[model samples]
Target chain A: MNPFAQKKIFLEALQALRLKKKPKETATKTDASVCPSCKESFSKNALEKSLFVCPDCGHHFSISAQTRLDMLLDAKSVRFLNRRLQGGNPLNFPSYEAKLAALRSETGIYEAVVTAVGKIGGVKVVVCVLDSRFLMGSMGTAVGEKITRAVEYATHARLPIIIFSASGGARMQEGILSLFQMAKTAAALERHADAGLLYISFLTHPTTGGVTASFASLGDVILAEPRALIGFAGPRVIEQTIRQTLPDGFQRSEYLLEHGFVDAIIPRGEMREAISRLLALHGRTTA
Target chain B: MTTPKPRTAADRVALARNPLRPSVTDYIDHLFTGFFELCGDRRQAEDASILGGLAFYKGTPVTVIGHRKGKTLEENLRMNFGMSSPEGYRKAQRLMRQAEKFKRPIITFIDTPGAYPGIEAEARGQGEAIASCLALMSRLTVPTIAVVTGEGGSGGALALGVADRIFMLENAVFSVLSPEGFATILWKDASRSQEAAEIMRLTAQDLLTLGVIDGIIHEPPNGAHEEPASVYLALDAVLTRELSVLCAQSGDALRKSRYKKLRAIGNRKEAL
Candidate 1:
């Protein structure tokens, strides 16, 4: 740290993440974490025991892609896919390369989304889990290519696929090419769907922008975690355009269920059971 | 392909957003015949922003759809200045399916700021609507073409842009979002739009090289708005040539080719 690295500047850096929820003031000295939705704090071990779900208010804290993989996949049944495909300074956007590199070492992942083939409930499936830690899980060229290749693989392998999306939208640093990723991913999913393969789109917190408007919304059965912000555009953009404060719980998973956009709101604990059950049912023949 | 007079990104952006520029309504009048405008998603409401229906393109039955731009404030309000709601996209999807069922060619003229970002739009499932359109268009067996007549904005424009062939007019601009929005979202300064526009590489020439678009249709020296008839003629020539080739393919062949073309966007040979 610089000799003059003050508390204020450190705090500002934490808040500058552009995340839907700011980190809960990381200056704490205790071995406890606070829930952003509810004002309750608990020991880190307690939070992990509940899978980071707030025991009091039931708020689902975001989890890392690795944490999610460990929770969903069976023991030693995971093989990563498309790790060679990662982001570049495609448009030469200033500081983009530096930011991506910083994120790489910080998150220990090559890109925002991690694609792999793994077993869920002992049933093999191709899975994609978008970690918002890197660029808010934005879909740029590499993220798009990885997903397209994932869907293509599932189509070829006759495997059901599930994608847990946690994104802000298109990666603006990559410019128009980021927006085109929407079409690219959807086009690949079209081939997958045509083969009569099952696709379950699992939207996590803060899935908006290009991601929501693409493959996330195209899933035959779309599922979301409780209270995840899933929509085409962000709430701030919508509020600014509408000139009105959104009603309570607007654009939330519950709201989407009320509006029929999502099939169900499955909690983090139930996700594995729900997804694996769907995959099993989909594989069944007429009886 | 570079021409003698290269337009700065800013210049192309300005020309594309010019109010006097030709709109989808004008193009339909000039090129299509026996036009019958379709309305309503048959779900709840009719979105005035996107207008689509049956038409004859040079005596060939086709389904035409596009974002509607208006000349007056009231008209623009009626059309929501071409920013679609979920219903607009649903209407487009309905039309695309109709075209596919009947085996008629589909042509879409894209020009919009984007899907309307408002409370009502979200309430109606805007993302699902656009995603459904892309899914349906990607697999459509009929010949399809999408032209960026003016502004091709984000998912709203892309909802209709998953085509077998996509072209952009010389002055038209297509990007993830408006330069102003980009600057605002990234830097919290909308005035940096010109700088953002430059980096966006949204012009037809840039997109062609990037393989984001298939071709470009040249406009007159003054601009397409100044010489609407010439713009129409040029587009007519391009569409006629392209459609003849696309129409020759079998349904299975067309489906495969469209899938391959769209899948190639981020799969650039210089992939990371």
Candidate 2:
């Protein structure tokens, strides 16, 4: 067997051995937990088929970047732009390099994002998917560079651009350099806009901090995934500083839509169709 | 006349002796004659932060684009604290293009803290939005004038600030980054914002001397926020005078002048 396959088999056998040793502990009675919004009990197989959404309640849980890419684009259609781009330990922050290595292994993706230039329902687009599993998809140099290059490609090709954002905020490890990415990305987007190309933004779960204040909010049509937390600062920090209770659904996608921050709120299942329709409406199609 | 006391907590307490500033609506009503507010970018939903429309300044037709910060909580939320998203800049670009096509002079009132910072904003290409505005303004044929009415922060301010004549209110400040942000980045403590502010050279007078601004439109003795009507009248006079000079130039001349004006900023001659 190949090394990867050998490793996988070894891991599976080790897990089986552990399970055998802890059979009594693993066989403990399970407590039923249902999604409060959807009133659907969690099932591993059902959730897998349903994109981790509650089948009964339709509550969309956070999804990984790869899963999102697979769900949005045509089967095997994604052509990622810069797969080789990687982050370095710029600040030499203790354990930062090791953390990145760990994240890379866990997520099976380089950097915080993977940008693809591909067709979604025959419409040409530059799509960037932020992997929340990797340091919460922070905007580091690699992430920012990938985004800038994607915009440049879209602008040059006169194709519409769409980016799915799911980030905790700017990477704290890179510090001021990470903050500079905001201006850099903004400058690039400005060039795309001048080219008269359409750019759409899809904000996903738990988007906050510096990312919220810069390029993420600059879409021609700003759409938020259902229940995504979109804001400059998290509610906990804001409340702690303000010394007051926040309103219900503060920074939630629905609240933002009502408050005019988001152009639309789209469910996970319908997002691809919605984006395709928008692309068609804008005449941004290759086929 | 003796200069007003330096802005401080004590000064602010003393200034409380005066009344609060006039609302943006009130200022516009008093200054703009035959004003008509335009809505939407015609491609997307209307952005409340960027207020664009046609207005008459002393009987001369001019297009007005202003960053508006509302007063109450509802209004503030609506205006997004005068921080525009991509659509806001797009709306301004639309208006500016229309103004150029119609041969009308363009006047912009800048007060935004910065462009809106959010994931949706980035995903939508906020950087492209601001850059597009800058590129469009750079090559615009019509006479363009920008007045810094309040806080002019970062690329948001620059999006509407590429003009033949850029004016600043006495109390207004313009900088590449906010003082608090610079302080936090440079000193690792946001509380040193006052020191950062002084070092940033962002005051209207400082910018005027640096040639980043064309002229300083004197605000009320207290500030524009205190007596907006007086500030607006002063702005009206300066804009009228600047517009006449800008209107006389041809398209090529306008583009060249603007290019020169921008290129001149931050250029220092070496001493041999």
Whole-model lDDT per candidate: 0.87, 0.71
Best by DockQ: 1
lDDT of 1 by residue, A45-145 (tens): 55655667887999999998877876677667899998756866667788888898899999889999999999976889999999999989999999998
What stretches of model 2 exceed 4 Å from their correct place? A1-41, A284-287, B1-272
Residue by residue across A1-287, what tens digits does model 2's lDDT show? 24344333323333443354321122122444467686767644345445556767777777777667766776556788988777565444458789888988887888888999777887778899888888888886778778878988999999899988889776766543454455456656766887888999899987766566556877899998888888765565456545777777767888778767789998765677789889888983568
All DockQ scores: 0.67, 0.09
Tens-digit per-residue lDDT, B1-272, candidate 1: 55667668988899999999999989999999999999999997899999899999889999999998678999999999999999999999889889989999999999999999988789889999998888888888999999998999988999999899999999899998899989998899999999999998789987897788999999888689888899899999999999999999999999888877876775675435
**Per-residue lDDT of model 2, residues B121-239, tens digit only:** 54454655775676677678888888876677766777788788888777777765566665665568888767666665567766766556788878666766766767777877887
- Candidate 2 structure, TM-score to reference: 0.53
RMSD values for the candidates in order, in angstroms, are: 7.0, 10.1
Those runs of model 1 whose alpha carbons end farther than 4 Å from true positions after fitting are: A1-30, A285-287, B1-6, B269-271
